[model samples]
Target: MSHTLPTDIRLHKKSRTLELIYGDINYELTAEYLRVHSPSAEVRGHGIGNGVLQTGKQLVGIKGIQPAGNYALKIIFDDGHDSGLFTWEYLLDLCQNHDQHWQDYLQQLQDAGASRNDGMIARG
Candidate 1:
């Protein structure tokens, strides 16, 4: 299936969220969500089944957003991570599956004993 490219994209620095409008759909993705789910090799890893779980990113904010040709975006995070190439399709998928993805992330954190706070312990 082909997804329509974003018509508008806006960053809310105070809320640390990105608002994307793609045709009839509008999505608000948080910085933490974007950071943890970055498509960069540092987060997604170099191969399948090798993704690194990201922690300590609950409050991470977007420092900037740049266009990557006509197909994707390059998001720079305040934490000095600036590698993820957020394609239009990926952004659409993230919007459509935000809840499920967030739940999965929470479960991963639980299983790994990690917390939203970096280097902090997760309590049972």
Candidate 2:
């Protein structure tokens, strides 16, 4: 309900990207990035060391974006991940620190001996 909310949010199927426009600034987020960085507890886990690492999302695409009240967007990934509530602040942070965050993600995968081509991590 605030005027600071994003004016436009669009998913481009051809490009496999989400575009967010807020005032005069615009951000383009790849579905891959969104998937890897989902805000769900399933991805983020419960505590500091409990976070789950997401892998093999390089080709993921956004299936849809639904509103969560007036504060966040629920993004459904083509891979069937739909629990994350992407709040305005979180989305903005992702847009601003994407490069660093992406690098960290790649490093995490390397450290875990994981490959982005291997699909999601198998959970028991």
- For each candidate, the alpha-carbon lDDT, in order, equals 0.91, 0.88
The C-alpha local distance difference test score for the whole of candidate 1 amounts to 0.91
Show the colliding residue pairs in model 1.
none
Model 2 — which ten-residue stretch has the worst lDDT? 115-124
lDDT of 2 at 60: 83
Clashes of each: 0, 0
Cα deviation of 18 in candidate 1 (Å)? 0.2
| TM-score of every candidate | 0.92, 0.90
Residues 1-124, candidate 2, lDDT per residue (tens digit)?
4544788998897799999998889999999899889999999998888888888788888889999998999999989999999998889889989999999999998878777877655443
Model 1 lDDT tens row, 37-124: 9999999989999999998899899999999988889999999999999998898889889999999999998889998877476767
Off by over 4 Å in 2: 1-4, 120-124
On TM-score, the candidate that comes out on top is 1
Give the C-alpha lDDT of model 2.
Answer: 0.88
